[model samples]
Target: MKKKYVRLISRAAVWSPRFGGLAFLILLFSILLQRFSVIDVTVFMILIIISACCVVVSLFFAVKALYSLWVYGALGGMKALRGIIYSLTTAIPLVLFWGFWFTLPALHDVSTDIQRPPTFFRTARPSDALPLKSVLIEQAALQMSQWPEMSGRRYDGSPDRIRESVLNVLAAYDWPVIAQKKFKGEEDELYIETVAKSFYLGFISDIVIRLIDEGDTTFVDMRSASRYLPRDFGANAAFIIDFMEALDTEIALLPLSQDEK
Candidate 1:
């Protein structure tokens, strides 16, 4: 009778795909839980880190198994290939996010008016998680350098009209208004506070829009700050830009009043 032989790497390869599958499921569940508000950001982040580690471990075993098969004629080649495929598929999105973390400015808060950014009201659930004012100023400077078009807009309309347009745009974007108020002793100045969620991760962000009436013109300034991470990978700035562009289109689509025509 011939003696059976089983290589160590072959055994590892057999188990690698199982471990990779577990990691993939964990990553998916964590994201879904976070997105649906079933879990908090801190817990979600920890789970993501764990899943990422599992992916790395599985990949390591898969690579070792492949090396063993090539050098020592080990079995389990198909298993090793499956593990490698699973690990890479799970890693692509994480790798892209990590790339953004390094490439973009490290800012979670952004505003059209850096010197006097729109303030978040109590209803928006403001947090002290933000950095110091000085640090924010430095970060805002960097943001401005990168996104120079991120500045206040002046529209040839009354604050009331512009506020309507702003609200319409917000509704279109699905940002829920949490609070709104008129500036104290300044009836013409309107403040609207809203919350935005990232499309995929559902990460929450606080947004405030300030509309100041200057005769017939309204000056619009907006501020957006992430609730969880200190680095937003430009999400806040992108949010403001998209909103502004939408509002611009919305206002343009509005029919000219009898007086204007």
Candidate 2:
């Protein structure tokens, strides 16, 4: 009985990698289908369902192979160990791939200023774009407490100079610059809109960066939002962080004015 059980587990371990490969192929195909608009939401969902099932089954077999090694002690020889290791080699990537999203917030729309997010210039913005719907007081409070540094930055530079810096940073990332406008009044407002693509499904995310001249300082506000989904998986927040970091780096490299220095 013990030998038969071990044999079954060993065979499952051998097949685990193939299951993992199938899961990966499904995921890739789904992404490609979505990228070209070849698949509807139902088809995409079905792909995900099938892929997830394959990954779960692969991991189960992998774990079972490892458990077999544990149960039989060292008697199963190196074959058992090799089977578990082979199973893990394929299953780990998929497990980690799906597991990563669990760590992200379910809320998709992330903004520097929740009160007044940067407005989109497009004719048909996503419904989730800008001016978030009111939430519970506790939820609002929690967000405020969590993302205090997410607010816009005010730098000691003219609007034109600041706008140039913003453009440089956005362009560096190869984000598609959708629209840019400089509105003149008592103080100029520089508005730039961009569409950023995701790596997984090539999904489109809209981003707007606004620069308001305040004479001595330029106030920079940026908002990133996904067009399709309710959850961005922290992409918006990460986008802002990367842009801000790169912007700061770019600005710091610039020669400071005598007065500013």
Candidate 3:
């Protein structure tokens, strides 16, 4: 019961009009608050994007003023309203800069579920361990009656394990894939997608699973990966770990380097 309450409170922290608000006032207020307070982000990362853009704008204008002394004679140059213009110009940069800073505490605090980097595990074949794609497909079909498709099958396992499952599934199939293949330094990624009328069903997890000797976006980058993970979709924390475990047992995983831990 205590654990349940903790979970409930953690959830309720973001359970507000701030996260679900659709009106202009609500959105504006959420953004403004997110500039300082951690937000419950359920939608596309409007908060981070907005804050970043604001920070950049503030920084740009502030930096631009530095050169104005020589180029435009301090920007407020000898005008009748020079005093007012100078003060306002100076305030603009301060406001924007502080806006980003104030929101730092909230923005910097990310869920531990997403705080880890991808670990590398090298694998040779799908049958060598477990067929990851088949597992999800089987489970989804059994549970949701949906078929999970493979994006690739180059059977290299990483600590990230998401790609391991992808490679495992692709290895199981002889079907021609519409997705890109593994290049010299590039590794394959696995995405399970299902679209329905009520809403869209997708396994959007990604990571750069560094392959042994092969490297270059081995997994999807995290900056935008929030779409599939708990951060964006509020998914189960154990999903990625479970996927990785399934891959480990079904497929071969050899660590290229020490695991990220």
Worst 10 residues of 2 by lDDT: 130-139
lDDT of 2 by residue, 81-111 (tens): 4444444554564466467656555656667
C-alpha local distance difference test of each model? 0.82, 0.70, 0.33
lDDT digits (tens) for residues 1-261 of candidate 3: 355422111212122222222222333555555433344333324543553344344334444444454454453222213322333444454465457445422111111123332321322222322222211222222222211221212344342454544456434432222233333324343333211110122323222222322232233321112222232222222333333445445655544534443
Residue-wise lDDT of candidate 1 within 81-145, one digit each (tens)?
88878888778877886788788787788898877777766543545455434225656668868
Alpha-carbon lDDT of model 2: 0.70
lDDT of 3 at 16: 21
Evaluation by lDDT, superior candidate among 1 and 3: 1
Which segments of candidate 2 are over 4 A away from where they belong?
1-21, 31-45, 56-94, 123-148, 183-187, 199-201, 256-261
- Which candidate leads in TM-score? 1
Which stretch of 10 consecutive residues in model 3 shows the poorest summed lDDT? 193-202
- Ranking of all candidate structures by their TM-score, best first: 1, 2, 3
Provide TM-scores for the models.
Answer: 0.89, 0.68, 0.23
TM-score of 3: 0.23
- lDDT top scorer: 1
